[model samples]
Target: MTTYNPNQDAHYQILREMLIEARQARGMFQKDVAERIEKKQSHISKYEGGERKLDWIEVLQLIEIFELSEVDFLMEFQRRVFEFNESTQTKVLQNVAKNAAKKARVRAEIVRLMRENSLSFSDLAEPPIRTRRHKSNR
Candidate 1:
């Protein structure tokens, strides 16, 4: 028996959605894509319905049939996989901006500390010195 994997299922679902969207966006029907890829309409339907997974070759074929460049197809796939609603996407962008600002502040602090301490690139290149120990007589 095969166990169900939610992650894998989600991945297939995203791919299926993107495939259907791309086909529709290009004003192509499933039948047309099926004919181009040498597959039956049912095969295209099954793939779009997430009942079947497309192998890499089939994906490449679909990309060609849809008249999409490989980069365009992959970019659409990525966009669908990480899609978010407008509000949520806005929040995420805001968080990213905040994080970037925080990083800039941290870098400024490091530069200030280095300057105040008179630190130089040569200091970083040199190795630490070890002290010698005297031998004791028994």
Candidate 2:
């Protein structure tokens, strides 16, 4: 029999966490994702917990299930994992800076959308109610 290593490296852990976070942010649970990917809930749980490793095919499945952009998603995942697990603290700082920059970009996009949609504070406020006229007056 051929030997196989699951290689549950930090990279795999980061990717797994990203997948779980994406699903959670969409109000999805492990069962929901498992159903979409045609896998068992336990499989997803194990994968997310980093107790089990994913193969190449599984990685592709995860990307699809999470609706991740192939180019940026994979690249960022690799970069963050490498930085996080690297022996050098400088790499970790670089990762932190990159993450902060990404957050700022996302916040800017949200602001742009709010402006484009003209969503003012009143948009979220409750409307005033008018008093009902009594039919007894007629």
Candidate 3:
């Protein structure tokens, strides 16, 4: 199984984007949100950059400051996450498939080389290392 970092994951990425979008929708700048929430502008910037994660307290404060409906926020967030997830997943899989095809072509070339040179599959392997053994004490 593959584990992606939070930055690479659609959920966190979408959350960060949605946060910035909500703030922008309200015509609020980082300075405004910072002042209203009693935080530094860097705090707003950091959280939106995914440098800092927003806890429930900050979340509620932003929700209030943005005047976003709870139901609307949650629904829109879910929809965006789903759409981002699907599209990004498809892009990643397509790249993987292209890489697989390229590798297959390379392997075919290697096989052709082996046939021309009359070499076995073992010819592709590296030589084994030779280990020296010290004489055993009687």
User: Which candidate leads in TM-score?
Assistant: 3
lDDT of 1 at 37: 78
Q: Give the clashing residue pairs of candidate 1, or none.
A: none
Considering TM-score, which of the candidate structures 1 and 3 is the better prediction for this target? 3
* True-structure RMSD, every candidate: 11.6, 19.1, 6.3
Q: Candidate 2 residues 1-138, lDDT tens each?
A: 956533346567678777777788778899998898888999889988988888878878767777777777778887876777565567668999999999999989877887999876576475768799778954
Question: Worst lDDT window (10 residues) for model 2?
Answer: 2-11
Stronger candidate by lDDT (1 vs 2): 1
Candidate 3 local lDDT, 45-133, one digit each (tens): 89888788877677777888899887787798889877877887898999999999999999999999999999888876868688999
* lDDT per residue as tens, model 1, 68-106: 799977887777656634445688799999999999999
lDDT (0-100) at residue 123 of candidate 2? Answer: 68
Model 2 residue 54 CA deviation in Å:
0.6
Q: What is the clash tally of candidate 2?
A: 0
Q: Which run of 10 residues does model 3 get worst, by summed lDDT?
A: 4-13
Q: List lDDT for all candidates, in order.
A: 0.82, 0.78, 0.84
- Candidate 3 similarity to native, TM-score: 0.69
CA shift at 102, candidate 2, in angstroms? 40
